[model samples]
Target: MTTALWLLLYGGALAWLAPPVLRRMTSQGISPQLGVAAWLATVAATLLAWLAALLMVIGATTDSVLKGNVVTLCLELFGFSEHTPIAGRVGSIALIGVATLTAGLVALRIGRCLSRLRARSHDHARAARIIGKPTAHPDVVVVEADRPAAYCVVGRPNAIIVTSAAIESLDQTQLKAVLAHENAHIAGRHHHILMVLRALAATLPRIPLFATARHSVADLLEMCADDTAARRVGTRPLLAGLSALAGHPAVPDGLAAAGTAVVARAERLVTPTRWYVQWAHRICLTSVITGMLTTPALIQVLCHH
Candidate 1:
C-alpha cells in the first residue's frame, strides 16, 4: 500500500515536471529528430509510470481482499469472527474506482479523436483524387488552385498535392525541393505521430503538457522533415521554395509545406549544427527518459522488500 502511494505520487510529479525540462532542452537547437524522440519518450515514460502505479494499487487491493477473506473464513470455522479493516477496504476501492474511471475516459476520448481524424483524412483524400489532376509522379497530384500551396495527405492513397499557382511560381529546383519536403512528411509517417499527439491532447485538454506537446512536437516534426528535404535538395533551393509558399493555408488533415513555424525552421536550416552539443543533449534526454520510466518500479520493488 505504501509502495502504491509512492508510485502514484512519483508518476504525478514526473508528469508535471517533465514538460518544462523537455521544452528547454529541445529549444536549444538540438537535433529536431532527437527532440521528437525525447518528447515521445517523456510521454511514454510518464504513461508507463502511471500504469505501474495503477497496477500496483490493483495488486495490493487484490492481495488484501484475498487475505482478509481467507482469515475471516478460517476464524469463523473455529467459532470466531474477524472484521476486515473498513478504512483500508474503502480506500483501496476508491483508488481502484478512480483509476478505472480515468482510464475509461481517456480511452474513449482517444477513440473518438482517432475516428474523426481518419474520417477527415479519408474524405479529403477522396476529394483530392477526384478533383486533382494526376502528374508524372504517380503519387503526386496537381490541384487547380490559384494559391501557392503544397501539402501531403495520408489516407487510402497517400499523396502530395501541389496547387497550379505553386507550379507556376516555383522553378524546377524549387518545385523539386518543395515536392521533396512533402515527400519527407509521407516517408517519415509524421501524420501518424501527429495523430497520436492530437488524440492525447484532445483527451486531456486540462493537462497543459499534452496540448503543449502536441503543438511543440508538430513543429519539431516539421524541422525533422525540413532536414530530410534539405538533405535531398540543397538547403538554398528548399529555403527559396518554402519562402514562396510561406503563409500558405494549411489543411487540418494534411501536413503543409509552410504550415508550421516557417521562420524558425528557416533559421534552423541556415544555422550550422554543432554535433558535439547535439550529442550531449541527446545523452541527457535519454538519461532523463530512462530514469522517469524506471524510478517508480525501482521504488515499488524496494518498498516491497
Candidate 2:
C-alpha cells in the first residue's frame, strides 16, 4: 500500500509537472537569477512533497495496524505497532491524498491549456495556406505576409516562416543572414525545446524555476540564431538587419516569423558585451541542467529507501 501510494503521488506529480517545466525552460528566455530561483523552488517543492508522502505512508500503515487489519503482520515486519492512533493516521492519509490530488490537477490543467494553445496555432489552415510549401530547408518557409518577421513554431512539422516584407526590407546579405538564423533554429530543434519548457511551466505554475529555465533556453536559442547569422553575413550586417526589423510584429502563434522581440534582440546584438553575455548564458544553462538532473538522482538515492 505504501509503495502504491508513493508511486501514485510521485508519478502523478511528475506527469503533471514535466511538460510545462520543459516547455517553459525552453521558451521565453530566463536569466541566471531566475534559473537559480526556479531550481531552489523545485528542490524545496520536491522535498516537501516527499516528506508529506513519507508521513502519509507512515500514518496509513499505523491506521491499518491499529484497526486489527491483517496487513498489520506485514507492517510489523517494517517496525510499526498496533498502538498507533487510527484516527490521526487516517486523517494524515486523507490530507496527503487531497494535497497531492490538488497539485496534480493544477499541473494537468496548465498542461492542457498550453497544449490547446499550441494546437490551435498549428491547426490554423489560413496560416498553413499562407506559409505555402515546406522547403528543402527544415526551418525556412515562404509565407504570404505584408509585414516582415521571423519566428520558429514548435512541433513535429516545425518550421520558420519569413515574409515578403522581410525580404524587401533587407539587402541580399542581410536576407541571407536572416535565413541562416532561421535555419539555425530548425537545425537545433529549438521550437521543440521551447514547447517542452512551456509545457513544464504550464504543469508547475508555482515553480518559477521552470519559468526561468524556459526564458534562458529562449535567450540561448536567439543567441544561437544570431551566431549563425553572424557567421554568414557578418555581425555588422546581421545587427543592421535586426535593427531595421526591430519593430516588426511577430507571426501568429502557429506561424513562423523571422524577427520576434526585435528591439531587445537587436540591442543584445549591438551591445559590446555580447561575448560576456553569451558566456554567462551558457554557464547558467549548464547550472540549470546540472541542478535538475542531479537533484532528482540525489533524492531517489537518499529518500526512496
Candidate 3:
C-alpha cells in the first residue's frame, strides 16, 4: 500500500510536468491534428495518474480504519507484493484531504462552465434565428451585422454565422474558404475541446501544464481547422480570406479568433508543408496514445515488480 501511494503520487507529479514539453515536441513534428492528439493524451494520462492516487488514498485509509490494517486489502485490490508495507495513517489522511479539495474545485469549475456554455448557446441560437437569415448553403446563416466577423453557433444542429460586413468584404472564393473553415470548426467539435481545457485550467490554475495546455490546445485546434479548410478550398484562398478578415473582432463565446491566430495559419499556408510528414511524427503520436491507454496495465506491472 505504501509503495502504491508513493508510486501514484510520483506518477501524477510526472504527468503534471509533461504538457508543455509534449507541446514543444509535437509542434516540431507533423500536423496540428497530431499535436491535438498529444495534448489530449497528456490530459488523459494526467487524469489517470491523479485519480488513481486519490482512489488509493481513500481505499487505504478506509481499510486501515475498518480492518485495523490495509496491506491485505491493498494487496488484493492492487496486486502489490506480499512484502509491501502498509500505508501510514498520516500520509493517507493528508492525501485524502488534498484529493477532496481537488475534487470539490473540479466539480465547481465544471458546473460553472456548463452553466455559461448553456446560456451562451441559448443566446446564440436566439440571435441566429432573429437577426440571421438562412442562406442558400443551408448550414449557414447570414447575420446582418456591420462588422467583418464570422463564428459558429456551437450546439446540437450547429450553425455557421457570417456578418453582412463579411459578405461585402470578401469575394466568392474567399467566402467559400470562410464557410469551409467555420464548417471545419463545427465538424471537428473544437468548442468541446476548449471547454474541457478551460475547465481544467479554471480548476487548477497553479499547475503549469494546465495553463500551457489551455493556450496550446486553442492554437492547435485553430491550426487543425485551418489545415482542414486549406485542404478543401486550397491554401491560397484560405490565406486570402484570413488576411481579409484581419482586425475584425471574433464573436463572443466563440471558438476561433478572426485576427489572433491568423498570422501563424497564414505562414503555415505560405510554407506548404503538407508533404513533409515523417515517420518520427507518426511514432510520437502512436506512442502517446499507447502510453495513455496502457497506463493501468503498466501500473499493475510496476506493483508486481
Q: Which ten residues in a row have the lowest lDDT in candidate 2?
A: 68-77
TM-score of each: 0.88, 0.60, 0.84
Per-prediction backbone clash count: 0, 30, 0
In the range 1-305, model 3's lDDT, one tens digit per residue, is: 54455456555664566865777776542567878887887777677766766776677776776666644334644465455554566655665677788777777877797678767875786668667888898567888878787777675567788889888988999889888888888888887787778777777778777778787877777777787887888888877788877877666567543645677667766875555355566676778678766866666676657
lDDT of 2 by residue, 13-112 (tens): 6435653664455343334234434444454445455555555555565565467442221233246644333334456556557766776776677678
Residue lDDT tens for model 1, 58-121: 6766665656522111123225465334335656667568878888888888989988987888
Q: What is the lDDT for 168 in model 1?
A: 93
lDDT of 3: 0.72
Q: What lDDT does candidate 1 reach at residue 123?
A: 82
Error of 3 at 105 (Å): 4.4
lDDT of 1 at 90: 59
Model 3 worst lDDT window (10 residues): 69-78
Top-TM-score structure, candidate number: 1
Off by over 4 Å in 1: 69-95
Q: At residue 172, what lDDT does model 1 achieve?
A: 96
- In angstroms, the error of model 1 at 174 is 1.2
Give the whole-model CA lDDT for all candidates, comma-separated: 0.79, 0.57, 0.72
